[model samples]
Target chain A: SQQGEEDPQALSIQEGENATMNCSYKTSINNLQWYRQNSGRGLVHLILIRSNEREKHSGRLRVTLDTSKKSSSLLITASRAADTASYFCATDEAGYSTLTFGKGTMLLVSP
Target chain B: GAGVSQSPSNKVTEKGKDVELRCDPISGHTALYWYRQRLGQGLEFLIYFQGNSAPDKSGLPSDRFSAERTGESVSTLTIQRTQQEDSAVYLCASSHRAASSYEQYFGPGTRLTVT
Candidate 1:
């Protein structure tokens, strides 16, 4: 079974708007990472936030991790049509390198 | 290639037949992993390889599913007596340092269809 679950399975937004997705996990984790998948393509790493950190930012991407609540959120600012893809959150528990992925959130950006 | 690559971008096979999926990790990468993503589902970890040590096969669903890697380079996933339920996109990934750097590079994946 998957450990993480993302809310709002699908989201549609216009270009230049901000997109936010949330993920919640069932167990404790060492770190959580976000990935973007293009249609029928491989996944690309976006950002990783460790358990000790509360928030992180990479360019237009912002990720927040709340270990106490076992939830995390990814925010993409100034979305573009090229940003339309499925986003997934993966968790790695302590001493466990194997990643447990969530169902994912499909984001569609319209021009 | 500069990134991970998988062979036979798409594969179609009949039920009860065996199929093999291959993955070629980036050069000098020590950790390799395999995952399966069914339609409308999350990616499931299948197996992992770290250098020359024993592989972690905890994620393999059954005995019929097995994977092997040679010298931290190429790896193969084999499924025996395939079933319709086994149809899914099989993905492979490799990390330069499994314990330290958590970044993993993924392959395009092989879309396997069992009839």
Candidate 2:
């Protein structure tokens, strides 16, 4: 079974707008990481937020984790058509090496 | 540095036939993993290999599915008697070390189709 579930299965936005996707998980985790997948391509690692961290940033991407709620969100600012892709959240259990992934959110940025 | 790589970008086989998928991890990475993804679903863990430790095969769905890694560098996943339901993208990922908090680098997966 999937340990995480993403909200708003799909999102569409104009190139310059900001897009946000949320994910909720069911178990305690050592960390949570986000990945992006272009259609038919490999997954690209995004940002990773440890259980002790609340927020992280990289370029135009921002991620937040709220352990109390077992939820996390990814924010893509000033989106571009090239930024369009499926985003997924994967949770790493405290004592395990395998990552459990969520159903992912598809973001489409229209130019 | 080059990232993870996998062979035979795509594969097609008739039901009941066997197929082999290969993965080459990034240099120096000690942790390797395999996962499966259906059309619009989340990734499903399949197997894991970390250094010299015994591999964790708990995620493999059946005895017909097995994977082997050669000293942390290359790994292969083989399925016997493929079934239509087994068709999906097989992804490989590698990390510098085996830990719950390490980030992983993924390879372009092999799309397998069982006819």
Candidate 3:
């Protein structure tokens, strides 16, 4: 069973605009991590928010977690063309070493 | 300080023929994982190897899929009697250690085309 499900199957926005994607999981998680894939290949780790954390930020990326709702969101401020890619949320269900990934949200940053 | 590496980058094999994909994780990383992505879908966890602790094979789809790791170094994912449905990008990732709090470094996936 998939643990995480990301909302907004796809998004299109012009450069300099902000994009937000949400993910909801079914199980309690140890941590939730966001990853980006370019050209449908390798995935680059973006940021991870532990169960105890409410929010986190790295560069242009911001993430917020709400355990009560079993959901999380990823916000990309000041988006750029290079940020066009598929973004996925992965969860470690109940402290499991393995991760379960959501279907992902495809973001298109048009310049 | 090289990142995770995978080979031969792309592979094409006939149905029923076996295939092998290799992954070399970052030096000293003790946790490695294998995943399969079909087209635009998300990653499907395949297998995981963490140090000497017995690997977690709960995610493998079937007996046709199997993986092995040598200590904390190289790992191999083998698919026997491949099917066209097996066509997908095989990705490998490694983290510094166990537990999900650590970030995982990924390799440039191997695109497999089973015809």
DockQ of the two-chain complex in candidate 2: 0.86
Worst 10 residues of 3 chain A by lDDT: A92-101
What residue runs in model 1 are displaced by over 4 Å at the alpha carbon?
A: none
Q: At residue B83, give the lDDT of candidate 2.
A: 99
Per-model TM against the reference: 0.97, 0.98, 0.98
Decide which is better by TM-score, 1 or 2.
2
Instruction: Write the candidate numbers in order of decreasing lDDT.
Output: 3, 2, 1
> Which pairs of residues have clashing backbones in candidate 1?
none
List, residue by residue over A15-108, the lDDT tens digit for candidate 1. 9999999999988888899999998568999999999999999999999999989999999999999999999999986778788889999999
- Residues B46-83, candidate 1, lDDT per residue (tens digit)? 99999999999999999999999998789999999999
* CA lDDT of every candidate: 0.92, 0.93, 0.95
Per-residue error (Å), model 1, residue A75:
0.2
List model 3 lDDT by residue over A1-111, tens digit each.
Answer: 788999899999999999999999998899999999999999999999999999999999999999999999999999999999999999997858888899999999999
DockQ of each: 0.69, 0.86, 0.89
Is 1 or 3 the stronger prediction by lDDT? Answer: 3
Question: Which ranges in model 2 have alpha carbons more than 4 Å from their true place?
Answer: none
Local lDDT at B86 for model 3: 97
Residue B112 lDDT in candidate 2: 98
For B64-97, candidate 2 gives per-residue lDDT tens digits of 9999998978999999999999999999999988
